[model samples]
Target: MTEPLHSGEVDRAEYDVERGKIREFARATFTTDPVHTDRNAAQAAGFTEVPATLTHTVVAGHQREQRKFVEMLGLALERVVVGSVKWTYLRPLSAGDHVVGTRRIVDDVQREGKRGGSMRVVTLETEYVDADGDPVVRLEEVLIERGEQR
Candidate 1:
């Protein structure tokens, strides 16, 4: 059985946006935009530094934090199903930026399954802020934990 769910922060971590990492990610993701890898090019393009691709947050170690979050909640990883994922970009995050991500449990609900078991839906939100505490990005993930068979 899973522990009771609560709506609050679960984890927080600081992520350093390094230039080499941004370049590597840009190459790996086939981001042809020079602004993502070349500082001079980025500067010419009116950016202060190399900017990361929009989906670069996927590699920011949030998955490990989420796994720990599930474990802390006493939920079995095998029984959990991803419902949906959403990302909202508030501002651009560039190399040389130190961003802090705070993860929270925003919603939890119990629902009756069509079959015969109960289901638990949990929504987790992670907010990223720059060094000056300005919002940079927001990520929300919905997970559903299935109950045991009848």
Candidate 2:
């Protein structure tokens, strides 16, 4: 049997934003807001560069880190379901910005179900800071699934 995942902080991961990545995310999320996709539109909008929404930053940074965390735990990705996600933005993230992500396991609990099953809910909180060390966003994600199924 595989060991249970240890609850702790994961190593921080950093990514330098690429123009292509920003454009792709914006397009994929259906964010047609010119300030997010077009450089000229962004400048016209009073931004020196395209600005990404909080959701964009969260998705790009958190998703990769979460997958790595699952791998570190030797857990199957398909066995887990995202129960909830919340993001709080402290500052705007521009297209050319670089971000560092720190993820920590905030809570873990196991419960027995009336149907003779057991489940675990794990809560993880991640903070994203810009190159200047200013916090840009904070995200909380909850994953839940049957304990033994994974």
Candidate 3:
């Protein structure tokens, strides 16, 4: 049996934003913005370095925490449904920024499913802070899990 998940800190991970990674992510996401790939372009735009694509932090290292959270909740992959995802960027993320993200379960709710079994709504929020301890980004995900039908 898996332990019950509470509204608390899950884990923390550090990611080093690399320029190569930024370019690769940009290409993968079909982002043709030169600011994401060329430091010269970014500098011309008044940025000190290449800025990551808007959604870069989503792939920075948050998925590991999400997987761990899912395991802690005793959720099977097949039964886990991602209801929504939201991202909040407090500052521009650029290559060479060392970011530390603290993942936490901010909210958990249990309710009886209208169709059959019980339902659980869990919200996981991760806050990424830079080396100076300034908040850089926040990622939130809502997951809905339903129990086996009776």
Candidate 4:
């Protein structure tokens, strides 16, 4: 078992939204909301362009943050388990908006388990901002058993 892990900051990554990508995500998620797939419908809904759902933003930016966090830990990918995820949307994300995401380690704890033996819980908070520098979303991802407990 390795030593207890410490928290660290991870660099951000920017993603440029593409219409085709939005449409594909909408289709795969079985989202029938016109605002997510049709530009006209979105504008009619008071948005400048097709607006992506909050869940869609996970793939757009948060996923990249998760990958970078894991890589920074120098731990094997297979050893990490995403225990939970929660997010808050500050503003709508449109199909053509560019977003940058930054992540910070919020907490880390070690506990002795009854069956899983020793375990560690790591929490990370990520913020996403649009091209205009406005906050778009905030996400919290909890990675459990990411490394050795001892």
Best by TM-score: 3
lDDT tens digits, residues 41-116, model 4? 9989899988886677667454465566567765467767889999888878788889888887777777766666
TM-score of 2: 0.79
lDDT of 1 by residue, 79-137 (tens): 89999989999978788889888888888877888987999888889899999999999
Report the lDDT of model 3 for residue 8. Answer: 81
Q: Model 1, which residues run further than 4 Å from truth?
A: 1-4, 62-67, 114-116
39-133: candidate 3 lDDT, tens digit per residue: 99999999999998888876656446657666877677677798998889998999999999888888777767787678777888989999999
RMSD of each: 3.2, 4.1, 3.5, 3.6
Q: Scored by Cα lDDT, where does model 2 land?
A: 0.76
Candidates, ranked, lDDT:
1, 3, 4, 2
Instruction: Name every residue pair that clashes in candidate 1.
Output: none
Question: Candidate 4, which ten residues in sequence have the lowest lDDT sum?
Answer: 60-69
Predicted structure 1: clash tally: 0
- lDDT of all predictions, in order shown? 0.83, 0.76, 0.83, 0.77
- Which pairs clash in model 2? none
Q: How do the predictions measure up, each by TM-score?
A: 0.84, 0.79, 0.86, 0.82
What tens-digit string does per-residue lDDT give for candidate 2 at 32-88?
Answer: 787877889989989888887557755455446556667775555666788999998
Q: How far out, in Å, is residue 44 in model 4?
A: 1.9
